[model samples]
Target: MPAAANLAVMDIPTPQEALRKLLLERLRPLVETPGRAQKPCGMQFRGTQLFSYCCFTTERIAAFETLQAVIGIVLNGTKEFWVGNSGRRFSAGQVFVLPAGTKLDVVNIPDDRRGRYEALIVEVHHLPPALAALPELPQPAARETRHDVTLTAELVDALSHAAHTLASSDHAEILAEHRLAEVLMLLRNDPAARCLFDLSLRERIARMVVAETTRTWTAEAIAAKLGMGASTLRRHLTQDGTALREVLATARMQIARGMLERGEANVSTAAEAAGYASRSHFIRRYRSIYGAVPSEHLAR
Candidate 1:
């Protein structure tokens, strides 16, 4: 892969490609100076569809969590998946089906060959029309809401192909939708997967926040739009372990990071979209979350 500025869609990294590069970078890690972005890895995301993308991991990480339902494919290496005190180890080719707001601790064990741990994770935003219209998934004798999903061989293959082609394909979003549709097919057949689709109102609010990052949203305003009182909405978010501001920032950061990763916008434009009046402020916050200022992508 060339410098990010020189690399077009053709040079974007697939999951496997990402893993390889991450390992190589680790051998000669770039030093991160204060107030400057780290050296850019050729690890560009192909698109901002929000429904799909690839993620690269090179070191051990823990306390991984987010507010999006994700379908994750383990491209290489085994990783420990911990839900509370109980823990389990899963290896390459296994899939992680996690509902929104579920918290899991993960520790990556790099494969000796690649020296990287990679997973391509696709976030499920609003329910696609296909899944929304789907009847509830089947139920076992003992019923419970599902929090995680198991991967099947067919799903693994489809998602692997999606990651492989995503970096080079012009139709990244389309490929993602196709893969997501396959996920929906799986969900339709499995009651456990479908149960994750019972997205909570708090999650709904979070999606709305993500969708409308530019809007100056307050709890009162959101409640008004949702036909509820401000205090009630606050209580709901509190129960979900978030607040109006936190949700707003989380949503804005996702969109902002996507815009930067796809090379869709410079830092200034992304700042505006994130509802910040100051580019410097946005950069500081962006660096805090992403470990780099956004503009550094072009410098690479």
Candidate 2:
């Protein structure tokens, strides 16, 4: 069959249909039985192949768990996923891994009411027999950690180009296999990489503080909420190579920068929304940390 001119631009009405289309397009050659129907609003990527698609809705428990072993990238929107039987939440930016056979539930909360839950889901089943023969796949960490990693525009562009290339060329499958391995390696090597699937209560609370960048948070307050002592909280953050305040500041700045880039807020508004009491303070701090003023940074 001939490929659609704008195959990547189609607005699949439902998540199930979208997954179905994606499988038919990307994984038809790998699976023995490729014509099976997916559960309502969901699709399966069978066998050993790489498949990618954008999801546009809040996914429930059953729906989310369907892609249990897949690794996904968050182009936009927040996804709250769980690992194992733990009751904790994990939210990340840009790229993150969803452990194999891990039950994940995602909620897409956009700043704007009209915002849709958009993500690029990539599934790779083609591992060399030798690589696949490892005793066990990388399992989720026992404790969850929060990371602040830089996702440069160059990296995003590279991923987009790779995805486009995979969708268009006959060598798409081969290219995807290589690219997915590269991405996984990059993430595995990152010092800040955290396990999204196995977060603890304390870690979840800490993540919540980070996610709500607008709130003016204090160690004592956060500790109180988590039912931990300020000293204990410091100990936990110390293990992560930075203090609680630094992490909080970084999180706020990251959110502010994203909001400014998206034109969701202007300089002062972004600063204030990120919990800065004064515009001057925000600008000075932003410049010191990011090496550029808010306006200059946003202009790029």
CA deviation > 4 Å runs, candidate 2: 1-59, 66-68, 83-93, 110-114, 126-144, 147-158, 191-300
Local accuracy by lDDT, each model: 0.60, 0.51
For candidate 1, give the lDDT of residue 218: 83
How would you encode candidate 1's per-residue C-alpha lDDT over 75-129 as one tens digit per residue?
A: 5566676777877665555555666656678776667775555555556665655
Determine which window of 10 residues in candidate 1 has minimal summed lDDT: 24-33
All candidates' TM-scores? 0.54, 0.37
TM-score (C-alpha, index-matched) for candidate 1: 0.54
Top candidate on lDDT is 1
Superposed on all Cα atoms, model 2 deviates from the true structure by an RMSD in Å of 19.5
